[model samples]
Target: MAERERSVEAMLRQYRELIEAFVQEKISADDFETDYIRTFTNDKCQVPGSEFTVLEKLFFDVDDYVSDPELRDSPEDLSGEQLRERAAATYSKLFGLE
Candidate 1:
């Protein structure tokens, strides 16, 4: 149980770093989305166990954020600014940076 918690915390730290990079414009929205919403989510998104509920939701949000509501019919990606906002928001939520 302790091991699992440590693992989860470690994973969260890695995600925080990635999100910070995106939020800082060190990484492009396209590249960040490719890593975060796609590849990076495959293993962490589900995030079983009730203890990780909020973290799981953040991962899910990132995955689902690929779509823009205004262009629902066409399925457009978010602008760089939008992606940065969300990444910053997610980082705040995940790390209690707010």
Candidate 2:
């Protein structure tokens, strides 16, 4: 379990570095945030919590996805459209929706 925690922490560090580099390279905040959201959502790591908040805070975004009430409460509730809407809203709030 300790190893897993270390691995997750390392990944979060790498993500933060990548975002920092993008910002340094004069990339638009909107583009950076969008890419971050897409990469995070498709990650095989299966982390939990609000991806937007986790990424914004540069924290290891792992949680009990299977056991979390918010996540499992309505497995069939968040449809594709709803997911997209939620993603967009979260992303926007985190990065000021630029």
lDDT accuracy of residue 61 in candidate 1: 52
Instruction: Output the TM-score of candidate 1.
Output: 0.62
Per-residue lDDT of 1-98 in model 1, one digit per residue for the tens?
A: 69778777766665777788888789886677677755455655344564356555545555555444565343434555765787787777777673
- Strongest candidate by TM-score: 1
Candidate 1 lDDT score at position 69: 58
Name model 1 segments beyond 4 Å from true: 42-46, 49-77
Q: Once model 1 is optimally superposed onto the true structure by TM-score, how far is the C-alpha of residue 85 displaced, in angstroms?
A: 1.0
Instruction: Judging by lDDT against the true structure, name the best candidate.
Output: 1
- TM-scores, each model vs. reference: 0.62, 0.38
RMSD of 1: 4.2
* Model 1 lowest lDDT segment of ten: 71-80
